[model samples]
Target: MTTLTTTRGDITTEHVDVVVNAANNAMRGGGGVDGAIHRAGGPDILRDCITRFPDGLATGDAGWTTAGRLPARWVVHTVGPNHGAGQRDRGLLESCYRRSLEVADELGARSVAFPLISAGVYAWPRRQAVTVAIDTIATTPTKVEEVRLVAYDAGVHQEIASSLTMATSVRILQGVRALHRRGYHGLRVNPGVAPSGLFWRVVLTDAADPGSSVRYTSADEAKFAGGVVDAMTTPHEVAEQILRALPRLRPANDAPAYAAWFAGLLAAVEPEHALPVSSADYFDDTDGWEIGWNSGLRYPAPPLDADSSQ
Candidate 1:
């Protein structure tokens, strides 16, 4: 029952049994997901596929090969319909997902991760592509326990996340959907200056925000003190930077300002100086107003009780 959305991450690193590579018909690495997978998995993967796939797969076709240096044991290669050839057939793209799952079933892969097929360098419309992918996966059945749709950018990931949230809402209305837990929490962090490796983690529980308003906690006190000088010298500049730390929590149509602010924060906070923490960790029944943290956490507050916090 676990479904999640992520942006631009390697599937093999998730420790999933297999990863789907959005490969070209020839099974050769092109751009986007195909090239990334090939580069990460190493040449041995290509060597294994050389003799087995002499005839290049056709559009809407899929194949498999051993994972070379990737964490997964196998890679499911599928050729999806690229929009470039004036192709707008939704069925063709849907088949790519169906066939990819079929290949995973045959390979006995317990879990698999998917990139937004045909969306990247292929130039497929993001919204339509997401709808097709989510719909196709929702209809498909398999032994696979999990299917993760990995996005290449924040906008992409946010769109997919919103779409899934909407779909889940509809299912709930139809009495077909059930939530695992209320008050779900998610954290996205960058370890380096640029936050290249965005760490996203989530947990579902009923724990309240800790009650305390200490600006400097045990974990962050030293860092806060070290940053005090910057804050004192450039107080206005630091305030501006803090104001810019908010990310777009909702769809673009709804929160463009938040998105802009998030970008600003990403630029403002030198990743080396002040890394953001998830909201759930910031506030609580005990802690009143911890101002220095980020708010990626979604709690089931009074009016929205039982609401699924995506």
Candidate 2:
């Protein structure tokens, strides 16, 4: 079975078998994810493109090149439809992902990382771009074991998580509800607090008094009621934040068990969001966390492990 996940990070650093680049038809390297990949993969990638694909490629088509200095072994280059250039064909956009996976299969790549094709400089609508990516990648069959959708922007991560129909999002929603049922109050995104870069906040208050609220930021800190916690940038991270707060808010010896359950839920879903925010301190201490329905999927969190130390 193929597992889908999302992350908030540089796609060039992905240690998968293959990393898909959202390239222009020229394939020489342009902007957005394409430029980042080309720059990180070093000159060898461009050299391969010059030698192997002297004539460039067409929109929606895919080709491969050496990874160069990147962590991955191969780079699958796919040209996305430029919606800003009057190219609005959904099929073309979908073909970019499909063709990339087909190319990955040809190379016997077990895992592939993808960026949101046509959503950047191509100007595809963010929500529709995410939907197309999820729909096409989920339906397409391949021997690849894992498909990672890497988003560099917090808003883009939230958009992808919201558009995903996988069971992980559903379970994460359920965990939010479970928090409410446990008598934790004021679980919301505080509009009073503005977002700083990729870091956002979620405020959880004591059920008895609304003013006695504890704020959780996208960083790790030690505090009583209000302090920095993990970044809830993706669905998995959101679920993890809730799970971590449960023990602090209420009496629950089974926090570890619940964490395990949520982790399992995350593993079962397609297009899962995986944001690693353990060492990121993008926001200042004065900028308290933001709280809202969408805030959960705007920041990143630590990875979920069987040891339950997430």
Best by lDDT: 2
Whole-model Cα lDDT of every candidate shown, in order? 0.55, 0.65
**Which one wins on TM-score?**
2
lDDT tens per residue, model 1, 1-310: 3244555555546578878888888886777778888888999878877866888788887888988899888898888787977777778888888898899999988788898889976777777788778767766767777788887688888987766643432222111001111101211111111133232221211123232111323223113322421111233332222223222211113223322333444333321122333334324523221212343322222222212322
Model 2 Cα lDDT, one tens digit per residue, 1-310: 7878788899999999999999888879888888998899899999999998899999999999999999999999999998999999889988999999999999999999999999987899876788678868866878999998999999998777655533233334444545544533223222122344443334544333456544544332222122221112233344456645544455333334444443443333222333212122453323322222233333222223323543
Model 2, residue 275: distance off in Å is 26
Candidate 2 Cα outliers beyond 4 Å, as residue runs: 165-310
Model 2: lowest-lDDT 10 consecutive positions: 222-231
Q: TM-score of every model? A: 0.54, 0.55
